[model samples]
Target: LERIVADVGAAVVVCEAATREKVVAAVPDGAVVVAGDATPASGGEGGFAPMVAPDLAAVIYTSGSTGEPKGVTLTHGNMSFVADSIIESIDMEPSDRILCVLPLYFGYGLYQMLTCVRLGATLVLESGFGAGGRIVQLLEEREITGFAAVPTIYQLLLSLPGIGEHELPHLRCLTNAGAGLPTPVVRAVRSAFPDARLYLMYGQTECQRVCRLDPEEVDEHPDSVGTAIPGTEAWVEDEDGEVAAPGVVGELMVRGPHVMQGYWGNEAATDRKLRPGRWPWERVLATGDLFRADERGYLYFVGRRDDIIKSRGQKVAPREVEDVLHAFPGVRDAAVVGVPDDLLGEAVHAHVSAEPGVELEAKALKRHCAGSLESHMVPKRIVIHAELPRIGSGKIDRRTLAGWSPRG
Candidate 1:
């Protein structure tokens, strides 16, 4: 918290009654502090202060693949474009009641509220997705029409006992972003919420959302993250800076008004992310995330450029291997990473967890992978765990998995 406060150069800190002491201690000496319980100041003479599109809106930090949190600076234009794009893509209306459990500090959750305000839609907040039974109840009781969350939240929802029997006819749309859901999880989500249109989206803190797959195309292109969100441009570029041919993997690039202003107070990091585009004044984000595209221009996330595992002269995408692991029966969570090896350069290692009461054998999972993936893509070693470690966003902690002891 201190690092973030310093990095972002925060002048004023806000806290609740419970955290006032801790927050006061964390903030710098001159920083002003406001407690949630403090009395409101009387109205001043000045009217509403105007804000331009380019004005800074918020700075949300994300734990990038390196495990270092970087503050992403977003502007009014970026937030507006994203909110409008999402509102249109999901066909959200004023009557829609959106349920959100993701933390508001994160962009995905913060936008849910902004989008609701823009649409005049009712926003229902939940503390978290713990146990998920209460979420199911909230869905039915609130008559929620729209819901958005990461893939892990969806997995927990599906695991709830008697989830299928719960009728959620009013649940019109269910959207997944932050990470792509595996094909089997897609099918399961569709089955569980027959009435909701499942939208598989992909994005990062650098840009709130890059693309979203249509519900109709999900079954056919389960692996795809779909086309770019309305008005945005997303494509894969090879190492030579040329557009990668369909099926060829390259770093994903995003260009549009929705791109962030840059990282807060970090010019070097900002320059690294926002590179020169087509024109002198233009800048485009080099996502540093590797992806491949289908002939139809649908984007499929491979892995982070840093996360790819080179094994036996073959480049293995952890996401591809994870998808296969997700398809295995009783598997609830899976994470794969590259471990040092003498012969393979970097050997593929997977850590997986099973559903409650289900026993998973590393050897059996290896056999399962053998039937579905190439020899090089299969895990050289598999570790079974009660649950895979995750970051705040609920995505698997690949950095932690990569640093694990071999004996485990």
Candidate 2:
């Protein structure tokens, strides 16, 4: 927060009681500080100049897993387009009440609030998704019509006993993003909320939403991340800048009005991602993620290009191995990475966190993978951790894991 305030040269800072002192200390010498919870007194004329849609709205910083966090500058138009598209895709209504469990600073959580406000829907804000019992209680008490969460939250909920037995008739929809939910977890989610529509979405901070799988197609295209969301065009492009054929993996490209302007104060990074599209003036987002599309246009997220493991002269997607690991009955979380190997260039390595009281042996896990994975796809080394490191957004910290060395 201090760095951001300093970077932007913010004139006023608004924060809650808990962070008021910190905000005051962080603000510039002449900057003003306002308490978020303080009631406003009667004032004179407060009208301000009208702003346009293209005007700057918010500057959200990236999680900086790959490198330094960059400020993503979003325009009012960008947010409005996203909110409207999501509202249309989800069929949001004035009567709908959304349960917000993710942090408001995260784009997913921020958009949830924006979408509800745009539709005049109710938003039940919570500090975070607490225990399964607490969340279940909130669902029943607040009569939540929709619920949004990342994959880890879903895993936690599924770990709880009697989760499938709970009846949440009011929860008309359940949405997942911030990372793909494993197929097994998807099944558990469906079983838990038998009547609600389940949406498996794919997105990034650069583009608010790239695609979303329809509830009806979840069974048939369980592994797919679905087609492009409303008002966006998504495709996979090869290194030569040509569109990839179905079943061929390539970098994902997204072109839409909802895309961010650029990374604030980083022209090189901005130019790398926001490249010229078909039109000379139009800039499209070249997402570093690797993906393959089916003949029907459904996308399968293949890991980040840099994260793809090169072993035995074959490019292996970590997501593919991670998915298999997640399917294991006792595995609660899993991450796959490539480690230094003199022979293979880089060897496949797996790090896992198991469910409480579940003891997973490396040999047994290798034996389990031998059945479903190809010889080269199986992890060469499997290390179990009490809990995998995660970022603020609840994504597994691959960067940290990539640098990890086994205890001597």
Candidate 3:
């Protein structure tokens, strides 16, 4: 098949008939294209020697700071270690079935699939999220025991006109990641899927899952991202370069088996992200997030460290925007931040809260920001909110702001 001949070294299975033909046409000379569900009928022997190297398991693509996509090469050992860590921590069972809406291209989604396959459990896949109706239907029809998604999915699903608890009887567990979830949306999801275990997961493509929350402890510690996954170490480093104590906010650093080997073919980025021989895994992924751990070592993710803008060349954290907004007469919550611009490197963007029955004006909020924050920190654009978009795992859908609406 073309994939085989073109040095697409990974062993790819053709799930659909048309896809099979395409693979055959592409690499007709060398590929062993296994078609259909029946493995024995295709002259196949079990446990074929892994065609990939020990340092290669799956290559997942992700968007980086350069505005270009990059492929992250994770070894089989890298992936296997993380999978075992997840299984060991959560104690997955053979009967578990996850209703998977995540795309295969995502490392998290692929991890879910590989984890299921390795554990001899089933992962029910869906072609699309469709709507709350479709998700509700899938839960009943497929008897899905687990679910996982980003913040956007949650926002879209919760907006469905007709949804209730009866529709999600089989959803035993759920996970949220990709972005940080808003507190209100997280509360809403917990109310809807009360029976299902909810975990707020955090990770990057460089390293798959760095942390996972315990469901029972959600209400007790709504802001915390939970303890480090087994085989993972998380700590806050102070500005002076020492480990921070409990409740002291600082840069979050992680060293674990799940940390990636390196960015494919980019030594500069690889060296920047992965510190060699740092621990048992020999690599530690430096997360850009600022966080603090509780006395018990439960980690709380604050926000991105780079999100803070240097206004008038003076550093300003976006959390300050949210802090100021909450002080307003009627505001309950806020997500103040910066967006890229041609001239300013970044421009302030404020999405704020409104009191019940009180219409908040952009001009008024703009004045409020001007009074509360430095002139440079005042949001150039003000967006009033009835509700902000969130995804399934209860995170803000900041990507939706690409087409933000300006209010009077």
Candidate 4:
């Protein structure tokens, strides 16, 4: 936190009572501290000026699951464009009440707040999804019309006993974007909240939102991340920098007004990601994610470019393997990674957590994978855990898992 404050050169910080002392102690000398709930000081209107569209609005840092976090600099125009797109795409209204469990510092959670303010909708804040029962109760008591969560939170909600028995007529919209919600979890969520429309979205902090799958199309393409969001263009480009044919896996590229200006104090990294588009002045984000589009132009997430495993001389997408694992009877969540192997340049390895009160064996999971996945894609080794390790962003900590071995 101190490093972030120094890197961004923050002159002022807002904190609540709980964190006021710690925040004051850590902030750099001469930095102003203001209570988030305290009334503003008088006589501040003399020098105030309205912010312009091009002015920097927020700097949301990435999850840093892979390495050091990069600050994604978003302009007022970027945030406004995405907010409008979300309101239109989701058909959000002023009368709706949205429940936000994600951290406000994260892009996904921040957008929820921005959209609510834009439409004058009610924004219900929760510190965290403590338990499934509590979340369900909030949905019922708060009369939440819209809810957003990542796959991990959804997995926890589905694991709760009698989750489907709970009635939530007020839940009209469900959005998942941090990570792709497993196909099994998607179906289970729809079954539990039949009245709510589930939207499968895909995006990165560099670009607020690139695409979203319409609720009506979930069944037809449950695995797809759908088409580009309004006013944005998304496509897959191959190694040669040409648009990839449908079903051909490649890096996902996004072109739109929502792209970040650049990484804060990291020009090399910025140049690597945000490159010039067709026009000399235009820039497009080269998302470091692997994706494929169907003939119908629906996008499907393959895996992170750095997460792909080359085993037995064949490139394997961990998402494909993880999907099959998610479908297993006793499995609640799963993660797969590549391990150094003497025989096959790298071997496929996996870790999975089972549903509550269910016993899972590595052999049984291996058999399940054999039934669904190709021999090369099958996990050579499987480990069961009470719960998979996750980073702050709710994504599986693959970097931590990468160093594990059979001996350990």
Q: Write the per-residue lDDT of candidate 3 for residues 89-136, one digit (tens) a residue.
A: 666778988877777766667778887988988988876564667877
Clash pairs, model 1 backbone:
none
Write down the lDDT of every candidate, Cα atoms only: 0.88, 0.88, 0.71, 0.90
Answer with 1 or 3, whichever has the higher lDDT.
1
Q: What lDDT tens digits, residue by residue, belong to model 2 across residues 1-408?
A: 778888777877777889889888888898777787785443458866698998999988877666667789999999999999999887789999999989888889999999999999999988867576788888899999999999889988888888888778889999998888989888888888889999999988887899999999998887788999998999999878898999998999999998899988889989999988889879999989999998988999988888889999998889999988988889989999999899998999999999978999988888888889999999999999999988888888888898898752
Clashes of each: 0, 0, 13, 0
After aligning candidate 2 to the native by TM-score, how far in Å is the CA of 362 from where it should be? 1.4
lDDT of 1 by residue, 1-408 (tens): 788888888888777778888988898887777898785454478866899998888998986545688999888888999999989887889999999998888788988999999989999998777768888889989999999988889889888888889988899999998777888888988888887898999888899889999999988988888999888899899999999999999999999989988888889989999989888988999999999998889999989888889999989989889989998999988888999999999999999998878899999999999999999999999999888888776777888888888575
TM-score between candidate 3 and the true structure: 0.75
Prediction 3 global C-alpha lDDT: 0.71
* TM-score list, all predictions: 0.95, 0.94, 0.75, 0.95
lDDT score of residue 398 within candidate 3: 54
Candidate 1 has what TM-score? 0.95
Leading candidate by lDDT: 4
RMSD, every candidate, angstroms: 2.0, 2.3, 6.0, 2.0
Q: Where does the lowest 10-residue lDDT sum fall in candidate 3?
A: 1-10
Residue-pair clash count for candidate 2 = 0
lDDT of 1 at 386: 89
